[model samples]
Target: MAGHDMLRSISRTFKLPEELFSGMPRIEINGDEEVTVENHKGILMYEDEQIQINGGNAVVQIRGRGLRLCTMTRTILTIRGYITGVEFLR
Candidate 1:
């Protein structure tokens, strides 16, 4: 925990994005039709109405309609559909 505290202090001092220091997921939502996730570990589930992503310390669950994996890479993922909800489970 001390290491994390030190990183947090450095981040604040440098005015850097917190996610650059914290191993946490960064999520971006574009209206109700698209979602992007960064710093994600991997996908846990994929379906027409639900998608689950492993986010290291937590899991990102997305629920929607006609869900599709638009893009995915080592650390980034993009989902497209009529997104109804998003949840983070730790």
Candidate 2:
């Protein structure tokens, strides 16, 4: 029974998404890691290596690496990165 429990734990570990360990934001990372923004209208300001995010009413999805958000406002978001894919689900 103990072995079974251990196996279950191990299996659960694999179930975790790769992004979770990579510090991948559940929302989005701005300026290619320069900043981080949440999905709920949150903004992040990045200068040097520090990151800041402001909360509001917006959703961001980040996938892959390197993102630069030049400007973001209500209903409009500007970003630059090696964008692989982007979609608006609303």
Candidate 3:
């Protein structure tokens, strides 16, 4: 197994929330207006139609109209506006 997979196994075995110890991405959506992404590596793409964020194991893509970036930090990203869809691309 890859190192990442092994880490995941260990994280699960310990009954720990992976997001705390792992770099795996965690996303929180508040209704259809706001979104918070944790452990985001970086923003790969951004536009009105779509926004792509790089995470540890997967990339998060948000689709919507009038999408706006509320804030971004080294480990977090916040988005605001009408969120039409969300997807994970591995």
Candidate 4:
């Protein structure tokens, strides 16, 4: 299993909040117009068609039209536009 998966399983077994470990990325979509991601390392690639950010074991990618950063900080990213797809790539 991936490192993050193992950490998640352990967190579950211990009855701990999954976010405690902070290895897995947390994503929240407020409708298709906005999306938020937590614990992302940084942005690797960005464009209207795609935005890729560094996560622990993989790169988190968001796809859509008129994609914009909107807002970003050390631990979180707020994106605005039509979020067509979300994925992770190694």
Q: What's the best-to-worst order under lDDT?
A: 1, 3, 4, 2
TM-score against truth, every candidate? 0.86, 0.29, 0.89, 0.88
Q: Mind giving the per-residue lDDT tens digits that candidate 4 earns over 1-90?
A: 467788888899999988768476789999888989998889999999899988876798999999999999999999999889999897
* Top TM-score model: 3
Model 1 TM-score relative to the real fold: 0.86
Q: TM-score of the candidate numbered 3? A: 0.89
Q: Write the per-residue lDDT of candidate 3 for residues 2-90, one digit (tens) a residue.
A: 87777778889999888876677899999999999999999999997789999767889999988999899998889998999999998
Clashes of each: 0, 13, 0, 0
Which sections of candidate 4 miss by over 4 Å? Answer: 1-5
**Stretches > 4 Å off in candidate 1:** 1-6
For model 4, state the Cα shift of residue 28 in Å.
0.4
lDDT (CA) for every model shown?
A: 0.92, 0.43, 0.89, 0.88
Reference-based lDDT, residue 90, model 1: 71
Which is the winner by lDDT between candidate 2 and candidate 4? 4
- Superposed by TM-score, candidate 3 places the C-alpha of residue 27 at a distance from the truth, in angstroms, of 0.5
Candidate number with greatest lDDT: 1
The regions of model 3 sitting more than 4 angstroms off are: none
